[model samples]
Target: MTGMVTQARPPRRDDGSSVQIGALVPLTRPGWIEAGHHLLAGLELAASDVNDAGGIGGRPLELVVRDTAADPQKAAAAVDELARLGVAALAGEYHSVVARAAATRADALGLPFLCSSSVLDALTDQPTDWVARLSPPQSRGWRIYADFLLGAGHSRIAVAAQPSVYWAAGTRILRDYVAPRGGTVIELDMSALTPAAVCDELAAHRATALLLLVGHPEPAVPIVTAVRRDQRLAETMIGAPAGQPEFAEWAALLGDDGAAVPFLRYLPERLTPLGEQVETALRERLAAAPSFVAYEGYDTVTVLADVLRSHGTDRARIAASWPSVAVEGTRGRIQFSRTPDISVWQWAGPPVQVVDRDPAEAEPGRFRVLHTG
Candidate 1:
């Protein structure tokens, strides 16, 4: 929990009328994309649920969505547009990149913002009430990961990856564990020009294990393929959980992994109790569904609806309710940090590290809980 502090804020009217809530985030990403949809679904359900149970101050709720493509620039633009529209607050962005952008965007415009999936621990690094993050932050998640690695006997580990915010953000987690205990760091480029160069680089580090943090579609294949083709590959290869989705495909293409690599994901079960329940509900609702982006879109709506229904149409009132609010969506507990703009500090909040999967059987639907650490 971040320290309580007062800050500048805006006032809202009490006309007992409906108001619009904005969600600026990427509607198109694998795995977590459905989170947005589930958010919306939960909100839509909450809207009806609330009205039936008696709406917030006797007024209905509405949610507006703006796609960010998980791109920071686009996210900022979306925020500007939403602010012009005069929505109550920012709610339900599942991606870290979009979440970070949401913070900056909300702060700049003095709009209240709430994050549904901004797990990047650096997001809450300052003092600002305009933005609050509902998802558990990443600090505890990193600590849990460090303990998991140490327990796994992965001492001589190497960190490798494509250049991405997710990858870049993850390096700090890896380094926290490695550098402190005298481990190796091998930065591999994901450029199309140097395929073999990537493999040789990791091998040169002479690490017993490697952790690859990759971006979309195929950036990780080259590094994995190179490692496999080379006989001198590290005995143990690991990767961030988000990068786990594509590894199975890449692993099959390379053939005969000899189990050299294990794509480790922070499992969903480890999220807050509510986060776990939300993940389960989502899987059950969209069992074997291809269009996961729908979930992301809907989830955003759900969280927004909850905030609007419970806190009236005031941005400050809604944001203030974040820390105590609950949304029964796909990822579970939606509690956020108070004055979340400075969420990066240890005082903010610690994100839950649900080990999505380990090396052996971490495929898309075949996730299993490793440890809650």
Candidate 2:
């Protein structure tokens, strides 16, 4: 909801043939308007860049956006309409529930569904052939995160997540990743508990580290707030992949240093070469669009243009090319698998930085990423 997506901008091709690309994700979330606009900006940027360089086989690329409001049923209907309209291909669906629905329908219709967001690992192995994605499976994200933390000498970890279809699935992936490695499973799924309760459990459970898995739009505020206030919790921790800036913002509301403290972020690590540059530029160029999900939408269109350009007017060919359609985007380096109808981007680690710090700084000793608890 926090991500901005753009509508169909005016075409820039001399041939006047703007290849239509369908979007099946939600466009009506709180920050979505601006996120959508940013997405559109990124898409338009991709299109203009492509056309200026080569014009996608001499035909400019275009985007066809439709809102699904994060609902699977509505997402499917949107995909159906887009398919009927005969767009060259589709992009930008974030949720796994919606992604599966759209991917299934696309498989049935032989249309290309280039999923942009959704970290649910299950979406990676879904039984569909129409999905050519640029976002990696959610489960794949955990392994990198797990390894990253473990590599950094963080083995005694704890986990938390909100209570939604998205976070529930994320909880499973995180639990699986942390448990097998002999790490503590303090509050594996925090969806059922209050943030204060989670801190109590973490303190009582004696967890040495923290890992949060968030996916729902804005449910993390209270949870992070409680964690920051509760003396039972440790300061040094990491967060899940879904909510980036939002997580930091929420934590900041709890206290000044709540957001800025170092946490091992999963998504930033996977940023592509250009994504890293764009992320840097985006931070300076535009206000941080509320949710990190916005970038998924931004990357989806960038890759869609690549596939449509390679195979002219052929959906199946474009779908098949998912595996070969390689590009560097804001989310990361994207490459979809042909055999499984899944796209997994490479992961890269970004230095942990804080956002939404309190208006004033605390004394140097007040807050730090040390384990005083």
Candidate 3:
């Protein structure tokens, strides 16, 4: 029960007749618990719906949930245990590095994994068919974010980065995309500086925008507060390309200061009919509007259930079905294919948007689409 989290829904039969999918999510500290909750909600909802509609060839769809707590080693261990337990496939993980660990283990064990929300470009060192992803890669999303910054006239940008492969990759993507367009990237080492110090650096560097490549609430919230309060940095824009502000907790913690801070979200401007229905159900389930991460979670199961039905739980067959997948997800039509520089079968066209909570809105969750890519 230490690493094991809730099962989400009880199995239809106590005789162990359910089809199991090992779910890796960050449900505890150091992980973004709010995001995990949303992600799990979508996964559980989709599974419940699948069971209602004939139960994947008459066996209940079960999610054996484990809390990764945003640790890579923890994720790898969970993957190994799940593989040993004979899950047909693996799903769900929000952190990129954690998902990478899970992907690596799943590949080595020959367990098919449909990564839910992690967007790291290099999911595995070598290409493997055992793994696939539902989220857009960090490079593609972050490069779009960089374009947004440039179009908005923010040429000099500063990033307060944490020491992590995901954050480092995001920083590198921004730098690579923006440098040729007369933009400069300044890195603010969060380990060596305080939030106030970060604000001072933003002012001193004359950074028109400060992108938070750090974690939420602890440093990201404080950094936003410091920047918003500091008169010297009043003109500088605050951004979170990794989408800290996409959750309700960000607005709850930072309130007005959290507004207008642009962040990347993998949602389209208009939801499809299925997306609209899922949104309503997800809102009712979560009591808050679901982030794009929830959609990714829902889509993960949607794809896996299709594969399981067609391929009949054979691990190799499920992995092999990645290319021929053509399921209608809550988003758009979901399919997987090899993308250049990416090691897994990727959903290459998930909608990418730079959005922000409207400061003028009386409601907290109201978002304004600023840019799309």
Best by lDDT: 3
Question: What stretches of model 1 exceed 4 Å from their correct place?
Answer: 1-17, 28-59, 164-166, 191-193, 246-306, 323-364
Error of 2 at 133 (Å): 1.8
Q: What's the true lDDT of residue 307 in model 3?
A: 94
lDDT per residue, candidate 2, 203-293, as tens digits?
7767666666554334455556666666656454545445343433444344453454333232453466766655654554456532454
Candidate 3 backbone collisions, by pair: none
Across 144-252, the per-residue lDDT of candidate 1 in tens digits comes to 6656666667666666566667667777766776677765455655554365676666566666666666654455555656676777764645445453442234434
Q: How many steric clashes does model 3 contain?
A: 0
Off by over 4 Å in 2: 1-17, 30-40, 51-58, 124-126, 151-156, 188-191, 214-218, 234-238, 246-257, 260-285, 288-299, 326-335, 338-373
- Candidate ranking (TM-score, best to worst): 3, 2, 1
Residue-level error in angstroms, candidate 1, position 346: 9.9
Residue-pair clashes per candidate, as listed?
Answer: 52, 17, 0
CA RMSD of each candidate after superposition:
7.6, 5.7, 1.5
What lDDT does each candidate get? 0.55, 0.57, 0.90
Q: Give candidate 3's error at residue 162 in angstroms.
A: 1.0
Index of the highest-TM-score prediction: 3
TM-score for predicted model 3 compared with the true structure: 0.97
Which of the predicted structures, 1 or 2, would earn the higher lDDT when compared with the native?
Answer: 2
Q: Model 1 lDDT vs. the true structure?
A: 0.55
